[model samples]
Target: MHNQQQRIIASAAQREAAQAARLKIRAGFDRSTAGLAAGMTQVNMISVAKDWAYDFLLYAQRNPQSCPILDVLEQQHYHSILAADADIRTDFPRYRVWQHGEMVDEITDATAIYTAHPELVTFLIGCSFSFETALQDAGIPIRHIEDQHNVPMYLSNIACRPAGRISGNMVVSMRPIAAERISEAVQITAKMPSVHGAPIHIGHPESLGITAIDRPDFGDASRIAADEIPVFWACGVTPQAAIMQSKIPFAISHAPGHMLITDIPDRAWMN
Candidate 1:
């Protein structure tokens, strides 16, 4: 009975923390949410016009590793089932507006976009950030969080399965894990398939067409210690790559590293 009571209290605390983080983000706290709301689930968001919604849905299905669908809001709706009373438009700390496949503006609030295009269908995809707490608990270090930097993501030569008009190379986020802990890191993350599963590649960045380790296509780069090996995982940012490559007419996505803090706890998705 005591343990059960403790579990309930911890669950409530996680929900409260998630809500508080969203409130601050709604109030214009523009920054990366990498280490924020520690034990809560975080998600990557992308909204596309209703016309392209089916195509994007197919794309996500074909590329589950990089685009695991969590909660999808139908056209004209902004609330997500993952978080009660949460408005998708203003909950994220930062947003990206894409026009003709180019990022035109980076804004703190995305209310205007949804207001202008009420026909947009929003998708909240699983993010790797949801599993960082588990990794930390296992004594695995997340260098980006340790250095106060956003996790480094790179565009890879990996081509996702094409669906309708959506097709693009995969984008991967990299973390340096100590050589000895590589197997343990893999085991911990593999249990949370909804949040990217496990490392797709380890050691050789060149195999993925990523020649530059110190430079990244998205987010800030972290240094890899000599004793560590660079580990890569399929990233939720894959949708943005699709938008850019496919030249989608209009789209809105959470800025890389700035995720939506859902009311759900990270353990909810653990296997």
Candidate 2:
């Protein structure tokens, strides 16, 4: 049965996540006392559906920045992947659930949504923070990191290539890179594709068809120094744009800024 196969896939994905969690624990973030991970992957527990697991995987595949999936774990209907000890519907500070291409609710949890929709899929896309390492490595001082505000993200006029029921313009997050080190930042990021890879466009927003640099489509707008030009990148939110355009029956994503932090290290960039 397709459902049975999906269960098997979910089981496999959970085990894979458990293994990564063990490795992550060995690397640092402990799981034993996370308060809820107990008896999750290591024992008799419900395994999330593979469709959900695959959904997260596909989202990660489609959107690398905003939806970066550090790990995925599976339970009867819950998948965390690398986050075996984590809770899918509640770990993030906020969740945005969409119906018919429009936001319906901004909730702190999605347990009810899953309960009602037997086929709803969950995804954990990679965040820009993953690539922030490469930027920092290149000596590009990320201003938002110091300010503690959510990194600024904007919906651009540029369009992302379509992928399976999804397609939309790119959503770019901005970082005020100094004038002197801009090239170094680009050169360093070009090497890491798994983490959004490199800047989609830089220098001027209007050139990219973005007329209001101060008015971002999403996230807060920051001060661009007189000397610094706003640098833009293809954001993970690109896929959300796709979903919006396609107007899928239903969808869900992390609230902008409240990212699912993975234990994966930034230095592992070379990987």
TM-score of every candidate: 0.96, 0.72
List where candidate 1 sits over 4 angstroms from the true fold. Answer: 1-10
Best model number under TM-score: 1
Query: 1-271, model 1: which lDDT tens digit per residue?
Result: 1112323223777888988999999988989999999988899999999999999999999999999999889988999878887899999999999998999999998888799998899999999997889999999989999999899999999999989998999999999999999999999999988889999999999999999899999999999999999999999999999999999999999999999998877877777
Tens digits of per-residue lDDT, candidate 2, 1-271, equal 1112322223454445545554453344422111112122121111123443454355446556434443434333464543445556545545677776777887766667767766654544444565675566566777766555556778877755455555567788888888888888787766655456578888888877778877777666777887787788666666566557767657777666654433334334433
Residue 246 of model 2: what lDDT? Answer: 62
lDDT, residue 215, model 2: 78
What lDDT does each candidate get?
0.92, 0.56
Candidate 1 is scored at a TM of 0.96
Question: All candidates: CA RMSD in angstroms?
Answer: 3.6, 9.4
